[model samples]
Target chain A: MRALRLYLVQRVTAAIMAPLVFLHLGLILYAVQGGLSAGEILSRTQGSFFWAFIYGLFVLCASFHVSIGLTNILQEWTSLKRIAAANIAHTFGMGVMILGFRAVYAVVF
Target chain B: MTTTHKVSIWRGGAEGDYAHYDVPARESQTVLDVVTYVQRHLDPTLTYRFACRVGMCGSCAMTVNGVPRWTCRTHVSKVTGGGELKIGPLANMPVIKDLACDMTEFFEKWQKAQSRFIPTKTRKNPMEPIKPDTPARVAANAGIECINCGVCYAACDTVRWNADYLGPAALNRAWTLANDERDGGWADRLKAVSDHGGCHSCRSHQSCEAHCPNQLNPAASIAGLKRLSTSAYLKGELK
Candidate 1:
């Protein structure tokens, strides 16, 4: 892909992830402060399709964000360019997505 | 009481060190004069670059006290104020010799950014009439005076960090060309600048603007390229 497209994707994904990150952090703080148990958290999350969808979108956006950032870092620091570096970044993002989705599924469904 | 100002000049190649010299101070002495004194009287073998002895030619640029500046135009009193002065080759470039850097990469990136003016009409055709009051003409005129001295390129941190990144001078050239209504290469030029190592790599540190001897704002030029490239992408012209 051309760099402009990559640049756009990175920016768009970052925008999507920003609010999601804040929401996730807020949820963690709220659950811990409220002394909510795993069972209580599960009871609140498991039956809600809204929670599943939001978390799913979060996982995708986070994956793209992390991967694009890593790709930029690797390209700047090393001699890697174009396809090889991008492929490595995509593999890393895929790994993040797989793990992230699995964890979200365990919590949501 | 010291009668002479202590000057440290970088000698030799990348692995070398700074050699100290005491230069006799004078009223309104320029950095180039100090370098000339050191070369002619102190060290016969010292190497540097200069031409015109004035600011017209942009050949004699070097690092003076950590800032890239034209040696010809920068006065000793203005920079050092009757104190010690450190002079070296420009930053973010390979030092070829004492106080001289190879500008191959600098010019190469100019080519990469497609900075050349692409004329749409053949020489046989009549000259295209362009009104100077047009916004595009005025914008093109704003940045057309760059003499390619490489000072802005040396001052750019992005170039130092990312080897492939096109520095300020090239981007500024591209911006001027992009604004030229007579230039028939906007599509290709925009594509070139939108590449991985192009205008998007700039972090807007503004070092290029800060160090420009001509007072030209390469940061603004790069910003213009960013806006143009983003719009082109939105319009599907950059796909």
Candidate 2:
């Protein structure tokens, strides 16, 4: 049952990440080629609810995607069993979320 | 002139190592030839399995140089480099003896995956004619030539990772039934294959398609199952 859940989660996260990744890439290209400074970018993005939400969702999807892939890799290559692999995956996802949320808070607030 | 080729054949069960033997190589010689020569001349006790020396029987399959291949048609020139060959039993299976793995689990998973076709009509009733060019029939025909060689099953990584995951051949067989126009239990079969260790478990690695002796594409069949399962899930047909 847990395996099923992980499989479904991976699929759902991949779906979400598809558009988020494109949007993120577009924004980076726009900002870098347009020669926008860090302060200028912050001024436009600072405390914006839309930017916060988009980046937050992006971070969440990325964390889920990376952790699930890493869990499978560990299971295949390392000595970790399913239970230990799940624990490690959850820890990695939580750490990414915490760090991501901190960035969102610093930029938006 | 009789030419000798150095062959290293696996000599025991699961825990065994490769044992080297020099055998006579000939024109159009095959990997099975090497094994047969070693067993017949060098050691009568050496064991392996083969029926038809041709590729039709699908009985003579083993890992030749880290790849699953039909031993009957796989010529020595195609596999051997520097006149050396390393033969072993198929992977992802328990070897019962030298070059022969126990295939009970392999075939049992076919049953578990419900690979058999379920009939919708009795023989006493009128016969139903199925159109050959219909979409379902065409899809079924695309992957129905599998001969149960166990090569794809041995080469699959998903089967190695999740023992319960139905290997490519069984799942491919299920895909054929899923597209059968005469079969009536597609809903049940789809649900059965949509479980944790079912069609969704396939990682789309394409190893089965790569190693299939008949050159059939089981990976595409698996993708078809995923599409069917997703549509079924949306329609509330799958729990």
Candidate 3:
């Protein structure tokens, strides 16, 4: 994608991630403050479709935002051609998203 | 009151170094005066460009002590607090000779940004009158006094990092024309600015605003372009 599409999508993904970030932080604080163990947290998340969807969407947005940002940085800071940079960034994003979704699944299921 | 001013000027092309000269400082001596003196008396081989030594013409812009500025308007007393001056060609441009950097790429990018004022009316048609107080016109008027000095171009980190990025002056010019109500052709111009090397590359460093001799805020102009481009994209008008 050209910078036009990439720039717009990066911004959109950032907006989507804002609330997700707050929710994740709030969950962490609540869990720690309440002295909840990993098993206890997993008990609440297990078989919960709502938690799965929210975390799944977070992983997707995070991957897309990271990929777009890295593409811009590679273009500006390196001698890599635009196509090569985009290809590398997309590959990296896909790898990261796969790992992130695996973690989300482990915690939820 | 006749102390000597030590000036270091760049010599030759890209591989040049500073050549020092001890010029006699006078009251209200501009940096342009020191350069002219070196070329005239100290070393005739010295070369620099200047016009309208009163600062109207911006051809005399050079890196004075690591900052890009109009040498014609810069006073020796103000810059040389250490009694020494270091002058070189403007940054972010290939040096042609001594102090004059090649400006071809700069002008080419300026044109590429499509800053032209394309009118919808010809001489046969009546001129369309625009109100001065309109917000768009006021925004246009804010950035209309650019002198094409290339200082903003030199100071822009975006242009330095992204080779194809159209520097501040061109985008500023585009913003001014984008606001002009009488200029009918905006679709093409808007597309031109949305390219990979267009206004999106700016990191809002504000270096262009800091170094512009005319006190123009190219950062704000670029922000304006960003807003317009985003709006156009939302409306499905820009591709």
Evaluated with DockQ, which candidate comes out highest? 3
**Per-residue lDDT of candidate 3, residues B17-112 (tens digit):** 888889997889899999999999989988789988876877999999989999999998888886689999999999999998999999999889
- Expressed as tens digits, the lDDT of each residue in A1-109 for candidate 3 is 1667777888899999999999989988888886878788899899988999999999999999999888888988899998888899999999989999998899888
Report lDDT (Cα) of residue A27, candidate 3. 87
lDDT string for model 1 (B1-239, tens) is 53787999999999899999999888788999999999999999999999997787888999999899999999999999667999999988899999989999999999999999999999899988889999878888888889888999998888987888989999999999998988998888888899978998888999988889888999999999988998888987777
TM-score: which candidate is best? 3
Candidate 2 residue lDDT tens string, B116-221: 9899999998998888999989999999999899999889998888777888998999999999988887876776688767888888999999999899999999
Clashing pairs in 1: none
| Count of backbone collisions within predicted model 1 | 0
Alpha-carbon RMSD to native, per candidate: 2.9, 1.9, 1.8
lDDT for B239 in candidate 1 is 75
DockQ of each: 0.45, 0.43, 0.57
Q: Who wins the lDDT comparison?
A: 3
Q: Whole-model Cα lDDT per candidate?
A: 0.89, 0.86, 0.90
After best superposition, candidate 2 residue B182: deviation in angstroms?
1.5
Which stretches in model 1 have alpha-carbon errors above 4 Å?
A21-43, A79-88, B81-83, B122-129
Q: By TM-score, highest first, what's the ranking?
A: 3, 2, 1
lDDT (Cα, 0-100) at A66 in candidate 1: 84
The candidate 2 chain B region of ten consecutive residues with least summed lDDT is B230-239
